[model samples]
Target: MIAPRFTAALACGLALAGPASAGTSLVIDAASGAVLSSENAAQPWHPASTTKMMTAYLALKAVREGRIGLETAIPASKLAASQPRVKVYIKAGQEVTLDNALRIMMVKSANDISYVIAEGVGGNVENFVAMMNAEAARLGMRDSHFTNPNGWHDPDQQVSARDLAILAMALMREFPDYSDYWNTGAVQLGKQLLLNTNGLVGRYPGVGGMKTGFVCASGFNVVATATRNGRTLIAVVLGALSGTERTVKAAQLLDDGFSKWGGGYTLASLPSQGGRAQSICGDVRRKGGGVALADDADSSGPIAAQAQDIGGNASDGGRFATAAAPTQFSSSVLTRLPSGKISLGPRAEMTPVPVAFGRTPGSASAPLAANVTGEADSRVARGNAPVIAPSAPVAAGLFGTQTGGLYADRGRTASGNGAIPGSTTAFAPADSASTQPGESSGPMRLQGAVRSGAAAPASLRAGAAAGIKPMPRPAARPLLVKPSPKAEPAKAGAASRKPAQAAAKPQAAKPQARPKTKPDDDA
Candidate 1:
């Protein structure tokens, strides 16, 4: 028989271990910091690129304090250039505007770009990292620390789901004016276009701007926000298996939180372990443990593969294996909630400011219209293709309808400008040759000839009209003559008369050889 005191202590130990060992997830009301649901909220995990949030926060703070303007030039340094992959590849001494650098860092998740901004704003990466930690502690993110601005993997650079939630909330609440920065789906840097990595940006309905991060050690993580019926909520998901899985799980969490939202306990009421998250990097097959429930039941069982689907139907329990079950409440929980809706936010309407390089710091330039056409000429001269700015409104119909996988328009030639011919917005030279059948003597004329089944030119036109002269057209190619078919071979028995005919035809005499000529003396 076991002692009553021992059994009671054992039960308490199991209960405490439940929440401590569960995977990290949390949802809270952005306005009141109310915790709607959470699991393993305080377990420390690698922040990955999500560290950009802190970097961005500090940058925005600096902007508010008048320390740096949006147009301030931030030069890339050797330290900034040495960062690992997922970088903008900006060389040392080159500079990017603070505004453009932030967009590139967030949208592209560029490691080097983060460093550029870090050095520019924080005076050095170490100083910036120090500022990040100081701010983290000030915001009550006790379980978080920063070793780098870009969130590149370092054992010391870490954050908990709760800490991330706090940072995200502070970002939204503190910098309402810059909400569109993270909200934007894509940005254009000269000819290079970068799309946001946050899959929930355009896919999940009402989902607003946030960030996403990933590394082998951290798996995939996201701090996502959504608004519906004038109510806004934020969800943090960590240690997901794939990009799709992270997004789907985050969406499901938002769906569950919103469905059950009724102003519950505030963020301060939720428990915190104040410890680092258990490293699952060594256990590749233990993905199921990340989303486990904080209860004594075997909720850590492997989630079904179907739960990975973003549009998958939920089970009768009102939960997909990928989504954490709602924490028990005094009221009965609804078995089913409305299906996840498409994010109807204004993400489509938001446009990133065009990033220009080589401009003097703080000098103003005319706003380039999205429909502007002549910019490609200079880019082409420099051997860099210009991209046609997208002008169409966001596509409608369903989630992820904006565009196919991150579209990149390297650059276009004068003739190949990405616009309809004859339009004012068309990017072509005044002397651009018409390809019409009756017209001739222009760059496109050869193309017209080929399309019309007429004689084609040896080469197409080259060079823009305003710069280098076009190469001369090569001489037209001569047509080849076809050989006639050979006559049938003579039959074996019928060929005997050919010898007599040959002797009669070859009776001509040979001429005598001429004397060899000597070198002329004075001809």
Candidate 2:
């Protein structure tokens, strides 16, 4: 038996090593694979949805290998359709293009779409899982393993912060062309619009693209990449207490790494440890008399408004009229890692609470239903403008009071104009009045007839006699006059023709007087 003092010390050590040891984080230089900052970087942790990163990697690999093309159609299988919420709800028989599937998987974090992609690329879910592990191992990710294509919680599925960083860097290096898929803030699928689960995409400046994950066993996790001033850094934050904390901590790590980025220790130089944190799952109490909250909030909740706005703008030929390409990687930095054997440690086993359908792994709430489609644009546009009821007919002498009346009848036919007979008001012919008092009325004269300028049109007088209310007139506008250029002195022979020219010019007609009416006639 151990001595009493030794036993007491062992208990203290075990207690100290509980949940506090679970939170692992790391930041690495994307170019050199150098480790800039780390905390329990080697400790095993659940990947949650970040597992989809590996899924994406394999799909891209297939595309590069010509096993599949971006345009290849992927049919949804029964297994794929059976996936829980946060999905596009593709019918099992329905097929989506490989490119679209990848976008949906990344932007929506849909488990169903992941399976669809897996089946399309690897022929089946099991094969896809095998391919994922094979790729992870090939990339020196000994501490990482994948059991499912969509990252549904399984005791065997796990990845360390360091391993995740390696996978992220490998993806950037191996496939630069498809980088936009991961960085997309949102995607449109027919009528449905799915917003990205990765918070840093639009929220953090300089953050290009990445993946976020959460599971009860993993807490909250994110593998984020950011570039600034030619330097790019990848941050792996695992077991964060909350989604906000996960984003904040990842941002903080990137900031610190970028600040001290020049010449750091290589990833191979970092120490490795075995065993997973058992207490990292639920809410953990911290030192400040506050508890570290579990990531109970849905990641999509904060971005719903943004998603709606984007969907609404898609149809208007506005900001999203054209498909947006992903932000490109900054100029490449030449940094190489020293050759060394990557240490592989024993795998740690922890009981994983299976993430249920309709709810994300660690989130307490289900994702908001983002069924936003083209109709959203119409809805939003309708909401923005005030609705106007039909106005009552304008009274007889109430012309020149409404706006836009001057040109209102310009597009209408004579019969369409609701002119009233015997009404005091009428629509002035285009040639009769000048928009501006002293502006040149070029081409205003009719070739033959010389009707009175103020006379109402025959159609207007007929309508008025039939008791149709006269069309409302436009609001009076201030008339502006440009001074006519001083007439040049007439030439010698031109004086005799001046009288004829004056006679040829059309004269402005005088205003016609209205007939006096009895009091009853005024009605």
Each prediction's number of clashing residue pairs: 9, 9
Top TM-score model: 1
lDDT tens readout by residue for model 1, 1-523: 2245543543343235333223467777654454566655666788888899899988876665445556566667898888876665677777666666787777667788888888877778788889998877666677788888998777777898877887786665445435545655555454454556776564455556578887656767788877654456778987775455566567667776666532323444333455554544533235434332111001112222123222111111111223434432111211222342222112222222334343342323322111123464421122323332322211010111122111111111111211101111111111443332222234211111012233222222221111111111111111111112442212211122123221222111122222221111000
Question: What TM-score does structure 1 among the candidates reach?
Answer: 0.56
Q: What is the C-alpha lDDT of each candidate?
A: 0.50, 0.48
**Model 2 lDDT per residue over 220-250, tens place:** 6889877665445788888765556666556
Q: Give the best candidate by lDDT.
A: 1
Worst 10 residues of 2 by lDDT: 304-313
Residue 337 deviation, candidate 1, in Å? 16
* Cα-based RMSD of candidate 1: 27.8
Clashing residue pairs in candidate 2 are 191-373, 296-364, 420-463, 420-464, 420-468, 421-463, 421-464, 421-465, 422-464
